[model samples]
Target: MADYTTAARPYAKAVFELAQETSQFDSWSGRLQFWAALVSHPDMSERLAAPGLTHQDRATMIEKVVGDEMDEHSRNFIRLLSENNRLPLLPDIAAIYEELRAEAEGEIEATVTSAFELTDSQRDSIIGALSRRLERNVRIVNVVDKDLIGGAIIRAGDLVIDGSLRGRVENMERAVVN
Candidate 1:
C-alpha cells in the first residue's frame, strides 16, 4: 500500500495545532476518527473513486451525511481536503493526530502480548512500571498469543521488551548455532 502517513503529516499537524489553540483536542479527535471511518467504508470509497462525482459533489455528500455534527471550521477543513483530493488520507491523518494529542497530553499507549491473559494485579503492575519508566501516563492494551508459550512482550513507542519464553528459546538456539 502507498504510504499516506508522509502526505498526511502536515494536515495532521495543522489540525493538531488548531485543536491545541482552541482546546478542542477531544472534539477534533472524535471528528477525525468519524471522518476516517466514513471515508474508509467500501461504499464511500467506491463513490469517492467514481469519476461521475465532482469534488463539490463528494464534499456535499459528506457534509449532508455529517450534517450538524460538523462545525464551520470542520466543514471548511473537509472542503479543503476534497478540493485537494486528500479525503482518502483521513485515516492516516487521524492516526497521526492522535499521536500528537497523546504526546501533548503526556500519555502513551502500550501493547502487551503474552501467552496467557493478564490478571488485574499483573496489568496494574505493568502499567505502574511502564508509567514510572516512561515518566508518562501509560495505557495498556493486552493481547493474548499462545505462540509466545509464556511470559510477555511489551511495546511502548520505540521501546520493546521481549521477555517471552519463545523469544528466550530462539535466542538460545541462535547462540548455539552461531
Candidate 2:
C-alpha cells in the first residue's frame, strides 16, 4: 500500500489546478479545510470509520455538516473523496494543495532566529535582503534564541544559512580537529 501522501498528491494537484484556473485559491483552501476538519474530528472520524456505515451514508453525513457553506465545486470534490474512501486523507490533501498554491505564486516563508528580538527596521532589512537573494517575495517569521549568542540563522525551504556565533564556533572546532 502507498503512504497517505502518495494517495493525497493527485487530489491536491486537481484541487490546486481548479483553484488556479478559476482564481478561487482562497475559497478552495477554505473548502479543503472544512472537509479536512470535519473528517479529522474525533466524533466524526469514528463515525466515518464505522464499518456499518456505507460510503454513501458517510458522504451524506459530511454533506449535512457542510450544507450551504461551500459552492458546487467543493461539494463535488467532497463527494468524490467519499466515493473513493479517501476521506481520511483530506487534511494531508489540504496541506499539499496549499504548498502547490504558494509555490505557484512565488512566495517563500522564512524564519530567522536571532540572539535578540529584531526591531521593525531590522526585520524589514532582512526581508529585503532575502527577497533579493531568493528572487521571490519573502515572508518572515522572527524567533529569538539566546543560544545563538549573536547574529541569526535563516531557514527557508531547503536552504539554511547559519551565521550564529554558536554555529561558527562549532564549525571552527571541527576544522581544528580535522
Candidate 3:
C-alpha cells in the first residue's frame, strides 16, 4: 500500500490550490483542522470505520458532526472523500495543507535548546541572527536543557547549528578517536 502521506498529497495540494485561488487559506485551514479533529475522535472513528454503514450514511453522519460550520465547498469535499473512501486521510491532509500554506507564506519555524531559559533579549537576538542567515522571517521556539552545559543548539529546518559546550566536547572526543 502507498503511504498515507503519498495518497493524501494530491488531495492536500488540490485543497491548497483551491484555497489559494479563493483567497481562503484561513477558512480552509480552520475547516480542515475541525474535520481532522472530528475524524480523529475515537467514537466517530469507530462509526466511520463501521463496515455495516454505507458510504452515504457515513458521510451524512460525518457532515452532521461538522454541523453548519461546513460551507458548500466543505460539504462537497467531504462527500467526495466519503464516496472515494478516503476519509481516513483527513489528519494527514490537514497537516499537509498547513505545510503548503506555510511555505506559500515564506515562513519557517525554528527551535533553540539552551542550557538555561533564554531572556527576552537573548531570544530576540537569536531570531535576528536566524532571519539574517536564512533570509526569511524566523519564528523562534525556545527550550531549556541544563545538560547542554552552557550553550545552545539551533534547529531551523534542515540547518542545525550546535554551539553547545556538550556538542563541542563530543566533537573533540570524535576528533581524538579519529
Candidate 4:
C-alpha cells in the first residue's frame, strides 16, 4: 500500500501541476472524478485487470466512456497510463489530485455524520465553526448515520470531534467500566 502510494505521488503531482497551469482545475477534477468512478466499479476493475485485453483496447474503452466529459489533455493522460499499464492507478491518482487541489485552494474536507438530516443553517453553522477552528475553508460532506442516535460526529482530516449521544454514552460506559 505504501509503495503504491509512493509510486502514485509523482503522477498525481504532475497531473495537478498540469491542471493548474492550464487553468482547467475544475475540468481536470471532474475528469479525474469520472475516471475514479469508472475504475473503482467492480466490473470495470475486472475488465481493466483482465489479462487478455490489449492496452490499445483499454485506451479505446476509456476514450469511448469519457470522450465528451474530458478534455484532450485528460484523454492523453489516460492514454499514457493505458500504455504503461497504469490504468489501475486512476482512483489513487484522482484522490491525490483532489487532495492537492483542496490544499492549494486553502480548503479542508470534513465529514459530518449526523443522526438526522441537517438544515441549511445548521450546515452553515458547522462550516463556520470548523473554518474558525481550522483557519481554513471547510467543505462539509454530510452523511446520515442513524446509529449516531443524536447530534453529529465531525471529522476534519485527522482531527475528529464526536458530539453524538452514542459517543457520550460510550465514553461514560468506558469510564464506569474503568
Q: For this target, which candidate reaches the highest TM-score against the unseen true structure? A: 1
Q: What is the C-alpha lDDT of each candidate?
A: 0.95, 0.90, 0.90, 0.88
Clashes of each: 0, 0, 0, 0
Q: For each candidate, give its TM-score against the true structure.
A: 0.96, 0.85, 0.87, 0.81
lDDT of 1 at 159: 92
Which has the higher TM-score value, candidate number 1 or candidate number 4?
A: 1
In candidate 3, what are the lDDT values of residues 1-178, reduced to their tens digit? 3599998999999999999999999999998988899898999999899888888897899778778777888888998899888898999999999878877898778889999989999989998998888887888888989999989999987999999999999999999999
Clashing residue pairs found in predicted model 3: none
The candidates, ranked best first by TM-score, are 1, 3, 2, 4
RMSD for all candidates, in order, please.
Answer: 1.1, 2.5, 2.3, 2.7
Residue lDDT tens for model 2, 26-64: 989888888789888999999999988887898889888
Best by lDDT: 1
> Residue 157's C-alpha lDDT in candidate 1?
98
> What lDDT does candidate 2 reach at residue 62?
88
Q: Please state the error at residue 37 of candidate 3 in Å.
A: 1.4
Per-residue lDDT of 161 in model 1:
100
Better of 1 and 4 by lDDT: 1
What's the CA error at residue 52 for candidate 2, in Å?
A: 1.8
